[model samples]
Target chain A: MSLAELIEQRRFVGREFLVWLWFESELFEGRFSLDALGACELWLEGQITLVQEKEQSRLKGAAPSSAPEAHEALRQGKLPSQARVRVTRGELEYAFLFNADAFALAGVKIPSVVKDAADEQFYERMYLIEELETLFTALYGEFLALRLSAAWETGVAPFVRAWVRGEPVDVAAYQKLRGKLAPVRGAARSRTTPPPAQAPERAARVVA
Target chain B: MGALKGSISFSKFYVRGELPDGFRDRFAERIQLRAFRPLTVEEDAEQRAGWCSIENPLDCELDHGKIFFNSYLNLGLRTDRWQVPSALFKAHFAEAEREHLAKRGREKLGRREKEELRAVVSRKLRAQLMPVMKVVDLSWNLEAGVVRFWNQSPRAHEGLAELFEDTFELDLVPESPYTAARELGLTSEQLAAFEVLKPTVFHAESTLGGAR
Candidate 1:
């Protein structure tokens, strides 16, 4: 199905489900957004197929290939596959395939700044670990160690790679991270004081 | 009150007589005209004989202020507004003319340079004029050649249009965009790529170990 259609169909889906799917599948919860999901769905529609495994019931079919082979074949041993799932009010598309162990790592979460909104299709990415930590710390400040672990599991690794390479992440996660970090940023701003003015000579010396 | 803290450019004026005595004096004293380097004149026997020499020059000599005033007046006429007085108008006109002359001195450039120059001029004019008009809210369009002067009061627009036209020689048309994009240091290609791959959703079809 087209991304728009899929998103529309799954528009009622929650962000948590999408987050869980992304985390469990790729473990690379880079930037997350509905648009990213939609694009993935569109891309997957052009690439994947679903296959079901069924055993040959009759002896006429011939002897089983081997004990382990029969068992492996029954489980569809390492089949190449792809699927597109829509989530969050049908606003995002998640495309995935049953291949590669790259998605086994912990999820990464990065803080995002909404640099431009006119082109809702693309966003600016900044990956300052401190910024991410500050945001999470502010959002779940009360949760202590549990929240930190959750953040590590869901946000650290993916966020680092995405931020270092300056790649986009899931939009929803980006927004959530920003929301989490807002209070911390505000507190930092409030706590800081402007430097006092110095004598002209001192200023000149500093400049020199 | 504190000299407005920025540059001011002026354009057209329809004075009944010599600018009202008090207005002229206040403008002359309060408005400081930034001076330009004097132009070098070549001495020739024929030129000297015709009274074009240093002692007795032409009847009407060009100063930075005069050039600024003329350009500012021309800009006012084009935009159908007048916001500059003789003093402020002359100062801005001179600056613009000098810049224009300097630009003409360049030898080679491409389309991008030309576009950049135009954008720079547009931005400079806007920056200088916006402050003088006391315009708190305004929008500028470089491509369309328009500047929308907006305020809570309608009467302010009348005087501003005239003052603006008198200062800059460009027409100040009025229209505003709902929003504008702020640059974030990303290349156009990167922005395009980010837009395309930004939305991807992943799903797990089956368990990793196939326990379920």
Candidate 2:
């Protein structure tokens, strides 16, 4: 097939990836450990755009990574084309608007600034940008791990399928993993504080 | 913000296919800088286009043990008749018709005469109009097949991809989530599953759905 045709054929995959990300964040609160990618934290932050071409409607929601409305739209066959997300690893945090169709990043905010080191600032900035790219690469690597795993067809696919259809998902084993990943709800949990509740239908509350 | 100061926006592509022998030499031939040339706008045509690299080797630098290469592709276009006012054309055509009628003793200029006049006017107008130039930056990792273009325009992306293929005979695939996953080394079974992969929905109640 021609290159354009090939790219068009893979468009759905990009949309699915966004959906997977939404599922991962809402279900596990953005905590996952993969043998290949190790422990990584991701959260959908700021604005998100979900497009449903057949319906000719674009649904948008902002902040609180767990937006139920966004999930609702996804359940209704809408897929995210763009999202503002925050990714954290160790002491570094990178926030950017990610475009699913183009796999592009814009308005990226790198981790804490390197203070007053004029001559070193240039190199430091480059280092941080490269680091962010590496993190993105690794995240994709993790997705590939789960996506290609045998469990995907045997179980995970069906699990995600059911969730996408607005059906209840209570597979106990995944729940145990989530529970283990969930932060303890007191003083020790401030770091993983649930995003503040939003408007009634739009609220992205992470149900414990 | 861009990968560096003063730069903004970029689109990502995953490089596929092996670089042929003497890749650098071949790449240099394709990306060598050229003097700016004006686009040749055909009469009555809406626009004409041509493109070339803005700089040779673009830029190469090393930072923290990694090498980065950047290049830019510039596309230029010229309009033939867009800026010429219809009134001016009408006036010119009227004068041309009058001259034709007087010379040939005919009441009106023939279709050929009118066409000829239009061509003249179009050419004149095109000479007065300036060409528009668009620049898209390319960032490549010397070791990895990662290419980040500083523009998301579909036309620009396709153009750059075509240029790269022509230059290095390598294909550029968009690292869409699925393609990326497949490239990460898939087994036969996984490949089969991927072929039939379907979009999954996320339900609020399904937070614990994958535990089994």
Candidate number of the best DockQ: 2
Docking quality of model 1: it rates as incorrect
Cα shift from native, residue A50, model 2 (Å): 2.5
Top TM-score prediction, candidate number: 2
| Model 2 lDDT tens row, A1-208 | 5545545665666666666677777667787554433566888877888887855234445563356676677667677888887888777888888888766777778775543432233334445666676566555555554554555544465667666765655646555433333221110111111111210122131232
Where is model 2 more than 4 Å wrong at Cα?
A1-7, A34-39, A56-61, A64-68, A106-130, A157-172, A175-208, B1-8, B20-22, B33-36, B40-111, B201-212
Cα DockQ of the candidate 2 complex: 0.18
User: Fraction of true contacts kept, per model?
Assistant: 0.00, 0.32
lDDT of 2 by residue, B45-102 (tens): 5533223332322122212112212221222211112456778768876776688778
TM-score of chain A of 2: 0.70
lDDT of 1 by residue, B92-135 (tens): 55565567657788545457765655445444444455222122
